[model samples]
Target: MRRALLAITGLAAGTTALVVLKGTPGVTQVAQDRPVAEAPVAPGGSAAPAPTPVRSAAPSAPASAKPSAKAGVSRSPGAKSSTGARSTTAALKATTSAPKPANRTVTGPVVSYKYGSLQVRITLNGTRIVDATALGMPQSGQSGLRSDDVQARYSGTAGEVVAKQSANLNTVSGATYTSDAYRQSLQAAIDRA
Candidate 1:
């Protein structure tokens, strides 16, 4: 009687262990050495991969065998299907096509000034100046002016505007011609605005 009881207890424990192991993720009862079944080819030329059997760990299906369109059923809940793909595509399109605010005109002092051979251009929107560039000076120096000089003039003007208006200032330093050009261009943009 003792030996029979022990055998029954051991069998129960082994069965429980098997169940627990199968419940774990990535643990499968299907032998790893078994060749995976290929997807069935529909009448259409393309071959669709077969869905793996739903493991006992997966959510139980509702009483109905047929899936509802709205329920978003893939072969397995984990699988991506044509319907899911279509819905995703539609979602992306909807998001992309949603109305957005139009670009607003930036307000600020559009100032352009020349320092020696460099030209500067600047653009101001609201209190913020977006950019400054020197357009026409050489790397070493142009005329009697260094690139730094041009940058200084452009930045100085923008800085002054920012100080007065409490506007944001964006500046380029160390390129005289580019800075000057930007300043000049900004002045034009401001004038037009």
Candidate 2:
């Protein structure tokens, strides 16, 4: 029994020592594998000069790790330097952007209604209508008031004309004649565009 107890104690101590020894090397390997940027620096401010010397001695590690570090250093300067990279990006943007069709104005023939005659001018960006403006609208008495209402609802960039992208618009409540004439003129302008 005495010999068995001694044997068991010896085995336990040997196991504990082996574990300590194995764990230490693993920790040192992990520290060595960490990136230079994450390596702990001495608090004495002499750490900067230390890395310069270490980098100069490329053969300190196995041949495998050195080639990769050298390749990374060589590739990074070409890939990330500001002048070359910026020009490449700018060239790519220029080619991709090119130029789009310019905006143009198309004027429609005047349409005569019972109140008066009104004409429309539309600004188009390529095939899309961007704005509508009434060039001539009734401006006397009750017809003028109705024309004003129609113009407010159907003209400019935010108007129903651009929003609907067509002459098919809802009639202003009390401006039937003005709305009809406006629609006709707007339709003509779209056709001309």
Candidate 3:
């Protein structure tokens, strides 16, 4: 009974693998005498370019089984055996040809000062600082007025860092503790970058 069950499972697995291979683009071909055009559905929902036909090892299917659409598929003299490898190679080529973006961003470590937590996120265009965002500045324990004050101070100090394109910002006058926290966080992010 166990052997019979195992045999059935193996057969099911084989059938599933076949179904997958049949649908995979450039991986399996049903025709042997002539290259059949098939818009084999790509891994992505979008259809990939027509597969370059490689020689098939499997027996040819009846003409009725092959799709009638011939325009989308064509035969190529040199075809790769593995569709996955070909797609990966294509992706690599595309990435290598394109230039990486000049903008860089880093999130600073959180700095806790005087019952408040502060963090800074900075965006850079090459060596110049483009923007800074303050995060986690509003203390849950503080009143609404105090939270608003902390946010304003950190943002103003962050603006100074952006304008000067440096983390060396002087503390905002009214928000000395928050300003110090911002400075520490900003420096940590810069060091990471």
Candidate 4:
């Protein structure tokens, strides 16, 4: 009886040790080679098989879906054309065709004067010149009166007696013709005044 009890105890201990070492009941013996089941289709409907995942080895475009060369369809959102050809020339022409030319009439008398090479037009409000503007002068090149013209005009009452005393400002280097034309225009305005 004692030997029988010892044998049964040893068997129980060995089984417990094996269970402990192998983790949970269904974990170690779980099947890895089982086939995946398909999702159930709805009743009364005919459906296509699921598409295969796109593979990197396959070409970017499918053989059956070729686009025409003349078609302006862009494959990528921001991809530039290799030839740099504009696609919508007619659309650009249609939009730009309706724009009218700008108005160029002087609202008041345009008093013109020459200060050296710079020609300036003074817009008059009756006898008083409201604003002096440099017209027909190159922005970057040497083609207008220098800072001295502005100073002389402001220091004297050229704005007040714009009609009576047609003043010519001293020109900077290479701006004499522009100033002369401006002075002549201002003299014409003064003569009109």
Candidate 5:
């Protein structure tokens, strides 16, 4: 009678343990049976390679079942194969990456000086100034020479406007008024940008 009770108690304990292990959430039966190694899933819900099955030496496993690894994994209609996934990833990366902002031109308001009115136009590659040009400036007599000096010192891709990337600039010698006007117009362009 003691042996019978012991057997029943052991059986109940074993059954309860089996139920607890099997009924646990987030753990599939196959996952419990095998160690699953999964690849990283690509963006856009693309399916990754299914876990490779571990084969046993037992003859009960047939050769026909060797190809069933991938067959067991279900994918969406738009899902790409592992090989096609590479190209899909490349395409996805290309599309997902933001394109550089197009080079834009912004013209500052006309700034007047002692000689004449001057305006500055700037080419911006995003926030950085790529080039600066004198749209309107003093172009006669002494004023023309000073305008030329100011343009040379502060305009173009190599000039202070692109280097400093701001309106702050050193005043060009003998062209203080033109430089100031240029700086003022450049500031306006920067503000607009």
Candidate 6:
């Protein structure tokens, strides 16, 4: 019984030592014998597998200097392409410059609603509502109003107003009172702009 226990303990210790040693630093070169999983075909077409880098003794050459044989286009990095010779890697320069828009902020009047008074300042950049900040949110007085929750719910609606470029926004769930107040204040700011 003593000999059997010692042999079992020895085998377990050896196994534990091997597992620890196998995981510690230097043992990564072992090729995985796992079966290659089928790669999904891309919607565009059959996509090429990403190239794996191999350790090499020779000095690496510049990617741009190495011209692709299949594609007739040869691209020169950082420099413009020559006439009659097409480049697949060429970047187009912008033909026209967009004028810089003036930043304007329109403050809305505090709309006294059933819940509380709410006011907002709407910042605009060329008709686009950049930001909407609630100047006066619903106060926690008679009603058990949470400012944070109201702000969080109204935030999504405010973002939609900016994205849609209109005050016509959907009311957030569980925050109808705040949403209504926000809409009126936002519309006022929009009209001011």
Better of 4 and 5 by TM-score: 5
lDDT of every model, 2 decimals: 0.44, 0.70, 0.60, 0.40, 0.71, 0.57
Instruction: Name the candidate, 3 or 4, with the larger lDDT value.
Output: 3
Q: Give stretches of model 6 more than 4 Å off.
A: 1-98, 139-146, 156-158
Best by TM-score: 2
Separate clash counts for every candidate: 31, 0, 0, 20, 0, 0
Question: Whose TM-score is higher: candidate 1's or candidate 6's?
Answer: 6
TM-score for candidate 3, residues paired by index: 0.42
What TM-score would every model get versus the actual structure?
A: 0.26, 0.57, 0.42, 0.27, 0.54, 0.45
Candidate 2 residue spans exceeding 4 A from truth: 1-87
Q: Quote the lDDT for 21 in model 5.
A: 38
| Residue-wise C-alpha lDDT for candidate 2, range 1-193, written one tens digit per residue | 9667666655554544343334322135455455667655545654421111111222233322213222212211113444345533344356667588899999999999999999999999989999889977978799989999999999999999999999999999999988999999989988887
lDDT of residue 29 for candidate 1: 41
What digit string (tens of lDDT, one per residue) describes model 3 on residues 53-108? 43332334322232322312233434343544454445535655856569888999
lDDT of 2: 0.70
Choose the strongest candidate by lDDT.
5
| Model 6 C-alpha lDDT per residue in residues 1-193, reported as the tens digit of each score | 9667666655554544443334312213332222234333335688423212223212233222332222222222333445655432232223234679998888988987777677878788888788776766655653335445656544443566667777787776666777788888888888988
Question: For residues 42-87, could you state the per-residue lDDT of candidate 4 as single tens digits?
Answer: 2447442322221122223332333334232322222244487543
Which window of 10 residues has the lowest lDDT sum in candidate 3? Answer: 63-72
Ranking by TM-score: 2, 5, 6, 3, 4, 1
Model 5 vs truth, CA RMSD: 16.9
Q: Which ten residues in a row have the lowest lDDT in candidate 1?
A: 55-64
Name model 5 segments beyond 4 Å from true.
1-92
C-alpha RMSD (angstroms) for model 2: 19.7
